[model samples]
Target: MTDKNIIWHKVLDDKKELPEGRVKTVTAAHKGICLTHYKGKFSALDNRCPHQGGPLGEGSIENGLLRCPWHGWDFDPCTGHPPGGYDDGIDTFPIKEENDAIFVGLEPEKPHETTVSDIMVETMINWDVTKVFGMVGHSNLGFADAMRRQEEKGNLNFYGIRHEGAAAFAASAYGKLTGKPAACFSIAGPGATNLYTGLWDAKVDRAPILAITGQVKTQVVGTGNFQEVDLVQGFNTVAEFNQRIQRDSRHAELMSLAIKHAILKRDVSHLTLPDEIQELKASSRAKAKTSKNRITPLTIAPPKEAVDEAVKLIKKAKRPVIIMGHGARNHKKEVVKFAERLNAAVLTTFKGKGLISDDHPLGGGVLGRSGTPIASWFMNECDLLIVFGASFSNHTGITPKKPIIQVDFDPLALSKFHQVEVAVWGEISRTLEIFQEEIKGETSAINPRNEIAARWKIWKEEKTKRLSETSDKGISSIAIFEAMNKVTPENAVMCVDVGNNAYSFGRYFEPKNQDFLMSGYLGSIGFALPAAIGAWAAVGNSRPVIAVAGDGGVCQYLAEITTLVNYNMPVKLIIINNNELGKISKEQRAGEFEVWKTALSNPNFAEFAESCGAWGKRVEHQEDLEQAMKELYDQSKPSVLEIIADVNLI
Candidate 1:
């Protein structure tokens, strides 16, 4: 019988231990089966209920009949028959007891069939979205299985995170770094809503990301079912393209469109998958979509008149300055060439830090609130401002009074706050290339390289003076950053959270060849650790990834340290523990308001890191900071260095 048709698989060790007149759920040949022991005999039946698809094993043996817990549906436990003579009944598998074990007989397994999740995942892969950061739950089991199949086939990589928020932030950072869409997955209700903050970060920063959230079964959607929420309405504002997956909807096409909108609009796109719809059988003729002629080139040149006017302004100005922002990240080479041709100083906004090396002769460092004195001096002295891809936020403080020539791919960003001399709507690289060509013979612009060097010298002297003003109570922010600047690798990827630590980093840490990521517009705390995880995923272990956060920021996602330990990620986390919300206190003082509710009671974070299975160290004095940093960076595993910092020294 085993060779001809029936395949007998051992399911339970012994039928005698199952007790009399009881039902238990077991798996045999990857199928859920309900094994019942009634009247001193063993029987097997499908575990799923006919109504509402509840588990029959969870039901009790009432009046010698199996009862489903969902709606109290009753059926005969031994013969798989209903008690009310209803037409609906479950199929039964042949069972036998021998050799102290129970074996269930089943037909030979058939070849796998494609599911709706398979089609959607295939479409996502076709669009080059292969990184998924999320959690698996009861509602999304089928989708998770589809993802598992793809991961087994080497088609994608899935990371199960500790929290849904971390998943969204990881996907956000991945999108920001690669300029491609990474997916975040979650269940319905709370799991879906937990993704809002990170999705808002992606939306505001113009990074592309895809959010896949699971929903309850379609039948119970409007009946206030468990774990059900109106996801489509919840994500309406944050997502540029939002849709729900339905049994009759085009599954592959919906996924393709989501990816398209994410990439083309550079914004969040969300999809809701009903629990039952995810497991629906796919059509044999369905095919995944690709990027074959579906996307257009984004390299647009500036208008001829605008370019001519910009050239005229460039020729007339004696002192010119170039301001770059996050949007100009990919076009740094062209921007540098333009700056070199004009012999002008190059300043970056806080979000645009590390675009131009601070060591460059023309580099004036970051501008605005968390900026250096060198950048502000150059901006104040310049006669004409040439801005590229900058939003002109108040934090950036780009002077509107200066004669400006602004260029951006989005027309709405040009002169967004106020009017400028020239508003050139074009792609950043193409516009810079045009400027380089148009200013070939114009050598009248002053060379500010010498002045830039002098200004940097003055700022360094001031920083040195501040670093010496240390307190016996705790380490100063300047001292911590000074040690970091000396020990941090040149090629490291740095993620900074929002706080006084971030401010000090922007002011003191001179980036060589590093890439800096931050919350930028959102200014959300607790962003560093999760962003560091995403950065490590993007670059792997080839380069070091560091996260800089204040004590208040690190405490928000403290459990994620265990996640790093679980993956053995080589991330060096530097926490400036001031035991207070230092940035808020400074802001309160600046606004003439009493600093209240800003102080925090904290724990020994280094000890916590060690408890989480990562290398941990604490630094109290300025003299020990460098050595602690060295020890932490030398480790081949995840590590943390917590410095007791002075709250008043920032």
Candidate 2:
């Protein structure tokens, strides 16, 4: 028998300096570990989530129970047992508090033999998943079960999104964040089809994503059972690896191949797992498939002659501009260096808004309705545009009348959806590096255009005047968002839903570092609250996450507020309390059609938020907006601030 040897683990200060009931986390043995003080006693557990190694420390805690952030796996802190039949429990260390300091005794080995659940829990303490995102559906339920099993085991974190599209978007977004391949999941049928939007977006944008989906039961294939849809057929449009797991065969090999294809192709890969097969036990010796990251291949240097040609092109041109997109986000340091070498003014699309800091000397925010005046000015004035990882779309209102030098890994993206004068096919950072070297040797200053600068100033003044006038009049959606932005922290994230709300924001709020995650391009409305939960789960309470939804959108997914309140995530939801499907209503009215069909009566949003145990407030007038915001921010809990504004504003 071994005597307990105490090893001190200092948590928060003893003076109640940190707020009571707030969970704090510490990293020990390079593992994210959670510690909390309750009822004058200290408790400690592995911070890594048991299910997928999500940061359990970041998960919400209420009473004496802790829930996993990745999934809502609830557990009692004292016993370390997850609620219900789920036999998962975390390793609890004995703790002692003495002289205002905390100490714990960690056992080198468990008193009992390790099981599969134990492996799942322990692995999350050290291992981390590259990326995980996807929609939740029936066939994928088994995968979700696998994820839950991993969570019980505690080794990694998987982030969930609203739809298959949102999942792919999140994976691509995370890839941009980490410069590595991200993992995504989806279900069969419609779920598979919805994935194309994000997968194609990833393809055009040149992002790496690993996508998984649930297929129909092998026996049901052609028989057309419930949810039995052709996943391979649906996924053919966007996925580089569209694989349906074989029946009664080597399933692990296929999963491994799917994972490998995603990494190697630098594109989206889709793997469809049948319902029963996904639940079947894998061989005990099964190992994760591995592959070299495709971004590693930068060996194809630009020929010196090609570099010289690029330099000459730059030197001879006036009003030259560089458009940085998600590609530049991956090779941030290299892109910055390249931009510095040319002294070119930079513009980014909404998706690439923060590829460089908004405060950077050259960045012009984004280019479109939400674009700064400078970006718009340069876009019209520049005769030579150096495009990198940017797609000129209707969203940007971009039309190429001048010579545009396109640089991208996706050959198809070289065009303005089929309009390009000069195309250079290669990796963005590598190509930019070659162009940068050439620019250094060239003599001309690539002089800034005075006309462009003058035009930008005038546009800025006009925009300022318009904003001021708009703010003073009947409450507009823009005014509401601007006010919200002013009160929230600089890093506060805002997740918006599709419909009139998304376009309203896209045309209104200025871009910030806080990611604007949405299901807009697909026009999915019941996405706001859940996606916000996922985003908060990803970033934690280090900052606030706000979900802006319309009355219709909120009504569709209001049940998720229970999840938010229960999780104790400090999220502030703002409902544009216009009691109608504003966009469709307006469209119908414009087309001289009946409006009642598009109109809807909604429940009291403030009451709904309160019902779920969160601070809820209603604001009818502009005068009450700031006060309502202040109250929500000060409450230090998940809350809903419903702002009743004119329906026409949307």
Candidate 3:
């Protein structure tokens, strides 16, 4: 073995070789590597993408490049340099084949340039203005420790939330915004349970997140000990995989699994560890490595014939509409090109807002509860509905009455109830980009600006009329969103909690780029403040992140106000003082159930923030609300702005 820190160990005897064009997982005593053999030579590197710790081993091989299973960053096996100018080296163990005996070497983690500096690098990465947000619990200690260590190492920083559920929401929103796995950490039992809402959201919404939770003490397994719960079972609520790192020998492997789950599944993963187990010292182990000898098989691209036909349908339609959802967000530029080339008006779902920038000529902003009237009418009147990269959720608040064209990576997402005219399946971004090019070649100049602006003009007229009639002088729900918008910058990021308040915030607030953050699928209310902090940390307080939270949500994680204050990150906490479960109240009124456990008394949150050494103010009137917000924003200090509103608005 060379002094470059190599270990000589036999991988296999002459009896075995990997299947042709396929990689093989070679396990050593304490580590494993995915070996790729090509032309009778082999190459290997660490198995995880340095960015989000995504699985490199499971990634496809194409033209001597190893593509990460998550985010598809391709890396050259020879030098371990990922695409997009990331030249980094992984722990490469030298392989020796002698007389049909194969051996490899492994080394300690060395300082080298990589995709991301550390987990903390997440805090610094641009989310297009979205922030890192989440709660911290005992169960998440290791994950949190890793994040904190990254921050301390000048690699990353995060906003800590009081409730684990909210943290999960923040993670979901952060992930959705950045296409990276944002994280949520909590203690075991209640902590894990609380995080389920966000986890389930991530699962359903296909938002990638890594959820970390603490487990019961290793020594007291199944003893009905305090705070002890079946984490593996509990984690089944939200995660694609519930991975328990019970032994030191399994930590690296479990981490690889976690990364694989988040990236490939495009869902949440839970990494659970017992309290003492995290502190246990283990011998140096080998990190998983990428293979050298495999190739990425090309899935036949969706026949271009079908896509060309879809384009023709768009060109002929006088009133065509494009519905952009999660799919569109993933393949933003491509979707934009397609819409523009077709001169089709675009309306995005809440989850996919800003998929096409608000500034785009064809932009209809968003379509839903808070969507402009023009957007709704566009959907209702369009003769053809072309939905790209999005699911038709009830939250969109409208169903297509016309023929629909749906394009997505998942064929199953083409319809919720409506039958699809043309269903094309492939990678959202890649396909969209391809479609755009094809459409450009087939079509001539059409004024997309005129189409979009015409719709926006009508919507703007209706919006103005509606805003004028609405009461803006009291503690109204609409007033809160409006006031916050007025005070915050155009680039402000708003991290919202789940429950009714999230609905209110998402609806009433028209956030542009860097303006809105929500766990659309997760819907965790307490996530607002923490997510704001994370966003602020990520962006270095360049813009303010306001957390619009309800009374119930605020109370669940009241302590995080102090976290904000202590960190001195530029985050504003806006508490909607609806004293009960507002969303449930609305549901009950709609004949769902009699509100029983939902009703509860609350505290003076403004004062609570003050107690935490933050500036706190309670607003009773609408006029005062805006003023107070202005004050909070001007102070640029940690503060809580409370709006005591009617209970109906929660």
Candidate 4:
């Protein structure tokens, strides 16, 4: 079995298992071997048919000849020779029987040569982009195998997902948290097309991500082959850099450039690999490229004049509020420091829910539609708006009429919606540093902490009143969030789906040091579970990952719960089963249309999770919510806690 050239493989099918005149396909050292038994003797032949790639083992032996399942080509069963000794024939391997056990002899597999896929994958690894979520298929087998080798070498982590869409969402979430690129892989046609929604999410949210797709063979260009689509053109609208990997392409440099674009631009970069080009041998002297000096530090400070004007405007205002967005995720310390020094109230956009702790004195919750009254009151009362890294999306409702100072790293994002008093173009952390240095003395701003506390008290009283309300239809969202507030770890990372549940969470769930991720601009449903998978990859168990979704949202990627179980990722998921698309229904009524086709017929998700080897529980009432959530988190595995709530309550 350990010989150098003729390595023996144990077929595991003993002599009794093979009847006379029968054949069965078995794998030997990763090669398929068709074992045939005829005339009280056994012989091993190659499993594949030479003509149409059919499984010869699945064919039957009739009239002393084996026939191919596809085209019925006949060959001598004993020697694997075609009728009349044709040049085309199947190869035969030596077989032996010892003590009624079967074994086949085959030459050891040839060492893999350096191919284009191998070089590209290695370059991606060298750039420290390790996480890949995707589905592997026929067109992408070469690239998948390359990744497999890299994974075996401990250089990459590839998660094979049930759906390409989930892979994209997971990669997007990883980029949002780490400010780096994670890859989503797919095959040609439908597989590649499925990634569009999640890729758009990354693009609009300014999260860096890489999308790798497979294309038809280059020889079939514009010939309309099966499952073929122009992936480069398809991906152009969603990707910052989109290209097709062709033969003789600059392999390693291409990968480096893709990674560079994703990270530096904070956008989606895509690459399409043709079927045949993926396996082409690379040049002998080719080497993987790295990100050693390609990226420079993003510490650009705003112009001195812009900073002076911003500080001057701050000094003249009585009440100044700081609005932070997802872009300021990493510079939390400096943003909070500047707010405290100026004695200004701080508000966060919905996507920036946890940028600052809600427990902080000056912290006003989320702004705009999915926001608290506390934030709305502060924004309305503030005379000056000092915005940092926020996009001023209509969802956030940052008033352009007010005197504003918007600081962003992207010059294009400055004054994107309307002109502000000062539009500072600089990196968030460095610009906040300059702001703190300039405003060393006390300003005309009032002690807003007392006012913030007063607003929070008023909101909490209303929330308490909502929480105690009972209904026969189902439990209120306030009560569900109240239970979540009790059990959720302060340091947990939450991935929220778009729905009324999101609105309720923003209004009721007080975020404290927890980082939040969502489909901020695209507002896609079904983002929660897959994004949690991504979050788990980023922070692992160091910070618990929680996904929040409504019934409609969870159903989109309901199968992904098994992905958590497969990877042993302990992601706690909360499903608010309201029995309908509550948000859409609300919108329909608001538009003065008859509500139709929004209701959902749901399953017992708790039992479904148990079937998938995960801990699960469903709570139908407020009294059982706390116990169910506690039990869900107690287990050291992926778990689901489904809460049945009233649709109208949210």
Per-residue lDDT of 192 in model 4: 98
Query: For model 3, how does the per-residue alpha-carbon lDDT over 277-338 read when each residue is reduced to its tens digit?
Result: 65554434333322222223323366687687777776567777888876566466766676
Per-model TM-score versus the true fold: 0.94, 0.69, 0.69, 0.97
Window of ten residues with lowest summed lDDT in model 1: 1-10
Q: Report lDDT per candidate.
A: 0.90, 0.65, 0.66, 0.91
Question: Which run of 10 residues does model 4 get worst, by summed lDDT?
Answer: 1-10
| Candidate of highest TM-score | 4
For model 1, how does the per-residue alpha-carbon lDDT over 52-164 read when each residue is reduced to its tens digit?
A: 77888888898888889889988889998997788899889999888889999989898879999999998899899998988899888888889999999999988888898
Q: Write model 4 residue lDDT over 1-650, tens digit each, in one string.
A: 44667988889557888899998899998899888999998999999988978999899899999998889999888789999969889999988888889999998889889999999999999998999999999899999999999999998999888899999999999999999899999999999999999999999999999999988899886899989998888888899999999898898999999999999899999999999999999899888898899889889989999999988998878999999999889888889988888889999999999898889998999999999999998888889998988999999999987889999999999999888999999998898778778977748988898888898999889888877788888889999988888888888999999999999988788899889999999999999999999999988889889999998999999999899999999999999998999999999999999999999999998889999998889899788988888887787999999899999887
- Regions more than 4 Å wrong, model 3: 1-152, 155-161, 217-220, 223-226, 246-250, 275-277, 284-305, 356-360, 398-400, 416-418, 441-473, 477-487, 498-508, 578-583, 592-600, 644-650
Ranking by TM-score: 4, 1, 3, 2
Point out the higher-scoring one by lDDT: 2 or 4.
4
Report the alpha-carbon TM-score of model 4 versus the true structure: 0.97
Clashes in candidate 4: how many?
0
**What ranking of all candidate models by lDDT puts the best one first?**
4, 1, 3, 2
Kindly provide the TM-score of model 1 when superposed on the true structure, using C-alpha atoms. Answer: 0.94
